[model samples]
Target: MSFFAGNISYNTKLDFKTISNPAAFYLTNLEADLDKNKIVILDNSHAFAFKVPGDIFKTVKLPKDNWLSFSYSLNFRWDRSNTYWHSNFFLYLKRANRFFPVIEPILKKNGVPDDMKYLCVAESGFTHAVSPAGASGFWQFMKGTAENYGLKINEEVDERYHIQKSTEAACRYLKDLYKSYGSWALVAAAYNMGQGGLDKQLKVQKVNNYYDLMLNDETARYVFRILAIKIIFEHPRQYGFNFLPRQLYTRIPVDEIKVDTTITDLAGFALDMGINYKILRIFNPWIRQNQLTVNQDQPVILSVPKEGYREMEKLSGAFEYTLSADTTL
Candidate 1:
């Protein structure tokens, strides 16, 4: 392993020509190459010490209820591997800056713990992903669950894609889970596996603590994933993610425009806003189709660029893809 310009790279060549279990071989390949200090490095050069670092609990700001067992020490080493220690983690750090500001206040106001926000990182890394089981959005709320949490999901609109609404719905779910399990760690585990599944395990094992229960691999790693995100993002530079403010995605402001009437053309609406259909959709993702039809007593909610908040009407002509030279916002 060599260090260059704050980046670490692992330079190991393996000829797996004679290996049958190559998948298993690759995961354990680096274990044999650790230095005397037990420093393990991955292809991305993210380095971690396997020999349980000093004051593990304090390093991670672990809750008093959580036990920093030997298993967790090992988990932390794995979490700090290239996957979490390198560019993947760096990108998450950047994206978190964009999404967390919007999520934090809601979580706080809804009486959920701040650490729970890391579940967003574990579920989707602040990106849009569709799970094979049909979970969607940054929160990965299942269709039924999203509906239960007040997120709209239908042929016309999927509020799961709406950042603010989805995060609010996620807060609702987390707070609900917290009511059942007073521990954040337990809540994290239950979030991965359903509440019923987790409750069964708790009863069978006679253990109320998340750290003590035996669980499936995904559920076992769920809280650890949240903890890993919390630790790495808390001290990102220490993990080699020295991202600049400009490198992060911008959290642009938007103004909501209420519409009760049906609109046949989204492109024309975008043109009227001095933008394009793409930009309009990017701002208001819940408007899923080219046309929006409001319910009898419901109004269609649309958010548009809030920058400058200029002239009431007058800014329409031949719509150019580029912004006008003198136009501000």
Candidate 2:
């Protein structure tokens, strides 16, 4: 028998540095005797290593004694799809630098994991104005659903576009979903599909784990999309999405002006404040009409965009704001 198993003995040069960070380490002298064709042993210890291919180890053999039993906990329990993982991960990381801040508070307030924020990226692509299948806004609340979630929607105002209001409404809806499912993953999945749909599938499939169940392509990819987003969002720089301070979206400045009376013309009111009607709607999306006809005299707060536009206008003394002539119309 030639050197262990071969008909002929052959020696190969070993590059010690190439095996950096392998699961096992071999001494220089012992490495010379290591059989390249067979698995090597390592000194036994209760330690984990980032396994790398092709490295010799000095393994230790520990006696089986008093191994404590522990309860099984599920850290990440989902069937990972290769295709979704790659695509969604890239998208999540691409928008993560901007989307994270806006979504974090909603999760914190709702008692959901902050990781769920990536679902927003998967839903709206970090755009507040995305409209897919008639779903609207950053949270993608549909008209009927938005109304159900306590978001006001009408011809003049759509609160779905307001970040804080929409997020709060989304949290309320999510809390309800969680109360129904008791699992964040299931809640997220149900958020994509309705509670009725998810419940029907759960009963039909006779399984609860999201990954194991066969679903419609969109629903199947849903949880994977969320997980991929969580992965990339958690480690943005690891995936080559780095941005400078100035490149990210900054919060706009505005002052809240509460109105308890009728506004005959919002365009005029906006102009009186030295701003445009477009800017007025841009800041206060809750204002649903070009003219606020207050029949009930309920005080509605309007946020007027400040800083660059307002401050300059204030300095120039271009316009001044006054209460509408008719308090009720």
Candidate 3:
């Protein structure tokens, strides 16, 4: 039997048993197993799903490092409810199917851990977003930080929104941060709050590690938020999410088109290439404006979709998980 909490029904199984009148009187003496001939068994399988792992993630392991602590554990417990509800965590689960494939290789190639892919989900929900503080894109780099990492961010182009380039840039940034801090937890915290801020905090607090240092709620909760992503997503079956392979969005495939020349109008440029402006934008989100004023100074590269590939808009409605977001890092 399935159970519904707040209109979201969890995949579950129900068991009903009955015995003959004479056998019913022997219930207290009966065995729990199937050896009894008088007992009726209902073996309907709805699939077992739990909103939260029944053990409350007791078996879910965090990265084994010096950083895992009582405070971080508490933070994990506190932050996990956001994932338990059908709303927040389910959205990440659906999108992870799409974005994880894209970002994982870049992180791995850059020598970052595969587990770090959860950071993207935490950063922007894998949505191209502009934070109120003016951070942008998948990795959520602010203006100066992005430019420092070699992402072009200006009126006509903002490669911070570019998945490939920005992911590579993030890998590089994380690599540098990891070198200095020697801890992924601290690197993540430093990513949220600048390296300078983290340095100052470490000095003031006299704490050498991220777990021991007290920080603003945002930075303090940051690593645990990421851990929460790690737990629910890595074990989606335990977290009560059930979807067919087709229902999950997969990696978007496209052909790369390099543009070094100035294009007065990108719409016309897209049409000449046999796709609409919207499709072009979906492919080349880094192209921020309708017009591209490209010159020898900097070339604008675009990822135009291959012949058979479809944008999310063109895909079957049933296949997509349409939802909203609050993309704050």
Runs of candidate 1 with Cα error greater than 4 angstroms are: 1-56, 59-81, 307-329
Please rank every candidate by TM-score, starting with the best. 3, 1, 2
Q: 1 or 2, which is superior by TM-score?
A: 1
**lDDT by residue for model 3 (160-277), tens:** 8788899999999999999999988899999999999999999999988877788998888787777766755655444444444455555666787888988878889888987877
Q: What is the C-alpha RMSD of each candidate to the true structure, in Å?
A: 12.6, 16.4, 11.0
Model 2: per-residue lDDT, tens digit, 147-167? 999888765567787777888
Candidate 1 clash total? 1
lDDT tens digits, residues 1-329, model 1?
11233444333334444434211222233334333334434456343433333555654545456456635644654555434345566567666656777888888988888888888888987766778887877899999999998988766578887888998998889889989998887888888998999999999999888877889978877776666566555544344443333455556666878888877788798888766776776666666677767775888678776755323342232111232122122
- Clashes, model 2: 11
User: Which whole-number lDDT from 0 to 100 does residue 209 have in model 2?
Assistant: 55
Give the candidate number with the greatest TM-score.
3
Q: How does candidate 2 fare on TM-score?
A: 0.63
Worst 10-residue lDDT window, candidate 1: 318-327
Write the number of the candidate with greater TM-score, choosing between 2 and 3: 3
- Candidate 1 lDDT at 275 equals 69
Q: Which portions of model 2 miss their true places by more than 4 Å? A: 1-102, 130-132, 286-289, 295-297, 309-329
